[model samples]
Target: MKSLFKIIIITVIFTSINSCKYYNFTGAKPIDADTFQVNYFQNNADLIEPGIERIFTLELQDIIQNQTSLNLVPQGGDLLYEGEIVDYRITPMTATADQRAAQNRLSITVLVRFSNKNKEEDDFEKRFSHFHDYPANEQMIGARLTAGLDEIYARITQDIFTESVAKW
Candidate 1:
């Protein structure tokens, strides 16, 4: 009886492992897609920050690569991601008693066009955005700026990933 139970357990594990192609714990099921492509995300915002495009492009690539079992290809992939930075700006978030700015919000928005060759109905174009707030006294530059940008990019990329792949 012990030997039979062990056989059953092994079979269950094997079946679970092979349940689906490109199955992952992140709730992404890429179906028959074996490769993906992320084209350069150009920064077209009026207030462009140098290298912001590169930062966003690389981070998106990294997230998809880390979360899915798909090869990163230069182009013509089963899954494709291409977009442009549409907005990058800082606006006053709060005002002090003296009528001076007390806090500022740095917001970034991206327009993405995602294509799934294997699933034509699944292709979509969407806008993803994120923001960070800082004290009005602090200049929106240097390390603080980089940190804020990084945080914003992380959120945007995660949203893109969740939409393009994660069914959840």
Candidate 2:
């Protein structure tokens, strides 16, 4: 019985180790290189919100910094991301019998230019967008606005991270 127990334990341990050999402990698998830089994202939308660009820029930096092991630099780094906010608008999503808006959708679109110094082929310029919907009667101020923006920002940042480093 003792010998049988030892054999079982050894097999289980070996199986687990072999299964995880190619798996990255971190959720993200950064490229072979290190160091990354994100330039301040500029708002290029016609109806620009006063501080949207700043908020977005900071959020992206925070997510990337937390997820990856790369160092953030000011100038060129092994990886670079720069972009502009291209669109910010609210559109009526649904209308009631009175022809009034029942729901409004707030959408934001960002264009990103990414470059990998080590691998030019991996570089890409793409657009990422997200939105949130709220009742048209509700004024999009205070907590309402904050919640809407937070939801959009979270999705956008995740998409950006997946494209830039996570390789998802």
Candidate 3:
């Protein structure tokens, strides 16, 4: 009886592990293709932030690489991503008792064009945007700027991933 119980437990464990072969915790669906390319993202915003375009491009590539098994290629990949930064703006969000700004929000918007060579139906052009708020008293430079950009890019990149591959 004890041997039968052990056999049942081992069977359950093996079945569970095998069933997860195609499952991705990030909710990314398996693709028919294996390679991806990310072109340089141009900064076309009215307000230009130096190096942000490069940073954004790298961030997008990083998320896809970390979440999927696809290889990154310079060109002629099974999947392609290209875009431009459309807007970068800072605006006041809330006001204090004195009617002064209490918080400032930094917003970034990117226009993306994704092409799937293997499945043309999955191609799309979309805009992803996100923002981060900081105290009105603090300047948006150095570490503050870095943190804000990181937060915005993280969300925007994730959204891009969901739209392009995850289908969620």
Evaluate all candidate structures by whole-model CA lDDT and list the values in order. Answer: 0.92, 0.89, 0.95
Candidate 2 lDDT tens digits, 47-159? 77788899899899888888877888998788999999999998999999999999999999999999999988889999999999999999877899889989999999999
RMSD of each: 1.8, 2.5, 1.8
TM-score of each: 0.91, 0.86, 0.90
Q: After superposition, how far is residue 125 of candidate 2 from its true place, in Å?
A: 0.2
Cα lDDT tens digits, model 1, 1-168, are 999999999999989978754466777875668899999999999898899999999999999999988899998999999999999999998999999999999999999999999898989999999999999999988999999988999999999999988866
Between prediction 2 and prediction 3, the one with superior lDDT is 3
For residue 32, model 1's alpha carbon misses the true position, in angstroms, by 1.8
Ranking according to lDDT, highest score first: 3, 1, 2
In model 1, the runs with Cα more than 4 Å from the true position are: 18-22
Question: What local lDDT score does residue 119 receive in model 3, on the 0 to 100 scale?
Answer: 98
lDDT of 3 by residue, 1-168 (tens): 999999999999999888667667878888888999999999999999899999999999999999999999999999999999999999999999999999999999999999999999999999999999999999999999999999999999999999998888
Error of 2 at 162 (Å): 0.7
Off by over 4 Å in 2: 1-26
Give the poorly placed runs of model 3, Cα more than 4 Å off. 1-14
lDDT of 2 at 26: 51
Give the C-alpha lDDT of model 1: 0.92
Which residue window of length 10 is worst by lDDT in model 2?
A: 21-30
